[model samples]
Target: MTYQAKLIAGGKIVIPAELRKALGFQTGDSLVLEREGDSIVIKTYAQVVREVQKEFRTMVGEGYSVDQFLAERRADWGEE
Candidate 1:
């Protein structure tokens, strides 16, 4: 769906209700805005995390669990 959103006087744009419902956006939902050249992208925060994790695993070749990594890092920082 396409929408022509207006930039408010304070530079805030109100998302249209129909687009929000279609995208599963809620009042408190977080969104990320990314600009690449002349184009812009918006996606929910959850989607960004999932995409980041997928890319990280591909680059790092994960074997150890997240719990183990965090524990080790905390110990290095003298954190319990």
Candidate 2:
């Protein structure tokens, strides 16, 4: 789903409603923008959260609980 938006003189572009809906972006939501060569990428806060959740889910496959993992690390470091 591609939409065209114009950048005004102040370098501000209003995101199209359809594009926002497709990206699951809501008003006042945070976004991260990055430049890749001649292209710009915009990601919403929800997108970042989804990516993190996916990574963490993979890391926890048949793994210890949060407290157990922390305790093991502390023991290894000799920090109680």
Candidate 3:
């Protein structure tokens, strides 16, 4: 779904309501913008959070944990 919006005087572009709803964006929500050559990419904060969560799950599956792993490392480093 594509919609057009006008850029304000100060160069602020308002995201279209339909697109926002489709992407689960709300007022005051954060967004990240990236440039890829001549194209631009925008993503919601929630999407980034979900990606990070997946990465952390993979790390935990690789034998890392908040408490036990840190304690073991500290013991090895003689800081325990």
Worst 10-residue lDDT window for candidate 1 reads 59-68
RMSD of 3: 2.6
* Residue 11 of model 1, lDDT score: 81
Count clashing pairs, candidate 3.
Answer: 0
Please report the candidate that would top TM-score against the real structure. 1
Error of 3 at 18 (Å): 0.9
TM-score of each: 0.71, 0.68, 0.69
Q: Estimate the lDDT of model 3.
A: 0.85
**lDDT tens readout by residue for model 2, 1-80:** 56899999889899998888887889899998879999999998788899887788788864647788899899999999
Ranking by lDDT: 1, 2, 3
Off by over 4 Å in 1: 61-64, 68-80
Q: Count backbone overlaps in model 2.
A: 0
**Clash count, predicted structure 1:** 0
Alpha carbon lDDT at 58, candidate 3: 91
- For model 3, name the residue pairs that clash: none
After best superposition, candidate 2 residue 6: deviation in angstroms? 1.1
RMSD of each: 3.1, 2.6, 2.6
